[model samples]
Target: MIVYSNTISGFNHDVDQGIIAEKVHNELNQKGFYNSINEIRSWENSLFYMKNVLYSPSINQDLNIAIEYNIPNTSKRVDFLISGYTYTENPIVLIIELKQWEKAERTSREDIVTTYLGGSNRAVTHPSYQAYSYAKTISNFNSYIGDNNIEIKPSAYLHNYKEEYRSELENDLYTPIIKKAPIFLKKDTIKLREFISSNVKKSDQGKLLYEIDHGKIRPSKALQDAISSMLSGNDEFYMIDEQKVVFSTVKTLVEKAIINEEKYTILVEGGPGTGKSVVAINLLAEFRHKIVNYVTKNSAPRSVYFDILRKDKYSLNYIKNLFKGSGSYFNSSKNEYDLLIVDEAHRLNEKSGLFANMGENQIKEIINASKVSVFFIDEDQIVTTKDFGSINEIKKQAKELGSMIFYGEDYNLTSQFRCNGSDGYLAFLDDLLQIRDTANYDGFDGDYDIKLYTSPTEMKEDLKKLNEINNKSRIVSGYTFDWVSKSNNDIDVFDIELKDDFKAKWNFSNTQTWAIDKDSFDQVGCIHTSQGLEFDYVGVIIGKDLVYRDNKVITDYTKRAKTDQSLKGIKKNNNFVLADKIIRNTYRTLMTRGQKGCYIYCEDENLSKYIEFRLNKVLKKNN
Candidate 1:
């Protein structure tokens, strides 16, 4: 939605009155979004300068301008949008990605430049491409543009950049995107006006933006469906905003690494459903001809993807070998491969192998085995005690390996592609688990089918019904129950037994792809088998490991299944801190596996009631 919209003349008056920034702040506050003081100040500075850019008499003063247009289903926003009609009276929108930079330097990576941001000189997405990607994101997901045929023009305006450094920003490496979405420096204000005027010569009463804002948002395809299409040599998941920026930046770095024989490491940090796997898969697709391996500590995702993507048994030889466990590279020679795209990098262990005595560090070994390494990580998903992956560890390894490192918004993924594109859901989840204090303590917005159930039988019945529709629904739980049938070849031995005759089996010991197994619905999955994957519906069974006690969420380490490996030795010297964290994170991850819905069955009545109470505050309907 447009936080603030007005005629060009009206915006000029507001800027002249020095209330434009205040208006934006007020509107964002009304929408329950947080804006920092620096962001408000930046808006103030940019709007004041934008007044000059829109002062041209040749341009239509009656044209509409919008500030901070919230893109549908994503946390990213358009900095500025001007809506008007083309010369032939067709509706069009100009998306301007505004940047306030005084100076910048060229990076060897294409579509990337080093600039001062966030208190450091970091590699950032080139402005023109950023603008283009934002526009493309809007067009791709917002159904209104395609339905109505409204034209979209994207460009970047760096009001503080000098004319002397024009050549640095105008590199040929970014030509294709720059040609599509031109960049305007302080000196090019008149040129920018001419460009804007050429596209939008008349006003359209701001109706186009109203429709665009209210347009229907196309839902992200199911993860397995997207992966199948992508593996079949089709571009199923289109990279949006930073996903595109990170993809392009990595491509450039890989090129440099291959041509110059240099080592480079890219670190991308994003929360769940931020398209980390999509980006990693796209990278593998792009570099399929080269020697590259897709690595992850968990085999669930790799196995499921291989199960879906493999065309036939004979075709699995090369494609199957491309996916390796994190421990596979421990003994590899230095620079043994070209690229190692590690997803769920936070789950990597310090040591490799089943005995955990092989490698000094998984991060160091992976980086050593590849000329260019890309790590997709979310620190919050480090649920196990052995998860040794972290930003500090990766940076340390890169430094010791003498590899160039890149990490920042330029490489970070922020869009919420999962959980129905509701970042509020994730924030609410964080607060629900008491993992972190957040503004979303009550609940989240969106039609995510979440319900707290007092009866495990009801939760499982509903989830099983959902599974019948697409086989995309499954039940997973915390490691509260032991695998009593681990060595027994019988399926009747139940590991999880709930009241009211509710009983279930852990996934069969030899079931490789438990996620998609046709008869797997009757079995239960744990954090190890459910991580790095998603489903349409999920029923989470919260165990006594976590309990709502004394008006707050608490954990009992000893309640965890004695056979569970995730928290091995976590209780040593009373390591309740880590145990508590892992327990909460496990439930959080389990509950979020559902794209459409999440049902909960809590072993503790207090925890179940607490969850129901919190969810009732935000969700209109709760069972």
Candidate 2:
């Protein structure tokens, strides 16, 4: 939906009189949209410059103009959109991204530029790339764009930038994006006008804009093809007997809910490596007619999935809509989505925002926003005190919302898909970690590979060797190292320093695709970046937060890094028990991230000896 729309002549007239900003603000307030002072200033600056360019005599005055057009099913909005017809009477939409930046610098990342934004120098998407991505998302999701044969062209206008400062914005690294969508500077106003008039010479009387605003949306063909390509020849997507049963049951429930116009909530509980994500992705691919989305609180799993499915430049736009964050439903309309498959529900936060006070509980909002909400959760994966997602909370919210709850063994996935499909390794780890005593702690004799190393250096070397055979191997550590270098450019600075010259840096904070980045194997991943993800072989570095003492496992919250927000304010006497649980849960989650083997190196010598003794005792008992 667009906040404001009018003919080109009307828009130019309003901007010339300095009343367009107020007009758009009033319209947004009428629609119950939040209005910020900065947003109003941006609207004033961008629209005034847009008016100056569109006022050319050669530009058609009857072409339709839309401002602040919201992308479908997302909170993102485009700056300006112009819809009209070309000389041959073909419908065309020009997506214009306006920036008021006077300066920008190149960054070491792809498709990102550093600029002064939000009171600080931060990295942001390049204007041309941003505009192109928005246009592609619309073309891939909006049914009208596909059915009506509308051509979409994207461009960026930096009206405040001077001609002499063009080299910074148009560097050799940005040639591909500039070629895809030309960037117009302040001195290029006449060229910008020519570009607009060349594409949209005729007027459509706002009919095409109206159609786009009220388009019937379905999964685009590109979305389906992307999913198909990702799932091809991947045996992991195949479901076993129990997983198939769960999938069939949930599919039936969703169909019934859609027909009856009723809300349904299904809680699918499983342990680590039980194919929860696999089932969620399969359902998303199968339910094409319905408005479906896959939600998660952690970006690790989502990034890996996107990196795999986004086969080409255009595929990323279509594939992004299939996944969303848990907090994306803050201001959503009730029952707007047909199905929301929430993966890793254990990571859902109670509140979301910079200060964590913007919205209500995410669980309640998600329940209220969809006709069918399927949550895939593993309660043991809640590694932080802020994570409050539990089966009881979901049931209580479902009961309060008057939605039918499907809770039973049929909805639970008991079969294991990871760790070489060995459920015994999971039970053994749980027993060894003292999270619970489900299995005998004598020894782990399962087919899954398990080893303990006294030196972190040797473990790293072994992991690197294993990665050569299969690239799906990484080293993960506890939250005891300072990651200050993550924000700084010195990502190569070793954050985790150990004896014997074993040093490694934490994973790059801006590395959205850390799971697939070529240089990430040398870095150590923390719990935040490794959870909800699996590797073929994993090397774990147990920090000093956990140690063995007095013939029992003990925890010291003080050993955790001050930068780690998960265990910020725990007193030894006041919250020791709870702090211990969270720390153990973090290590447990990290240890189980491997699907084939797990190698461990503990910081505390006592803890290492204790683990070795326990394993030897178990071996003796088995013999």
Query: TM-score: which candidate is best?
Result: 1
In candidate 2, stretches whose alpha carbon ends up further than 4 angstroms from where it belongs are 1-236, 312-314, 487-492, 569-573, 618-623
True-vs-predicted CA distance for residue 68, candidate 1, Å: 1.7
Q: Please name the candidate that would achieve the greatest lDDT relative to the true structure.
A: 1
lDDT tens digits, residue span 423-503, model 2: 656777788888788645765433356789988999999999988864778999999988767667664566889977898
Q: Write down the RMSD of all candidates, one decimal each.
A: 3.8, 25.9
Structural RMSD, model 2:
25.9
lDDT (Cα atoms) of all candidates against the true structure: 0.85, 0.80
TM agreement with the true structure for every prediction: 0.86, 0.62
- Candidate 1 lDDT, tens digit per residue, 242-334? 787688788987887899899999999998888898899999888888899999999888888788777444268876678899998878999
To one decimal, what is the Cα RMSD in angstroms of model 1 from the true structure? 3.8
Give the range of the ten consecutive residues with the poorest summed lDDT in model 1. Answer: 614-623
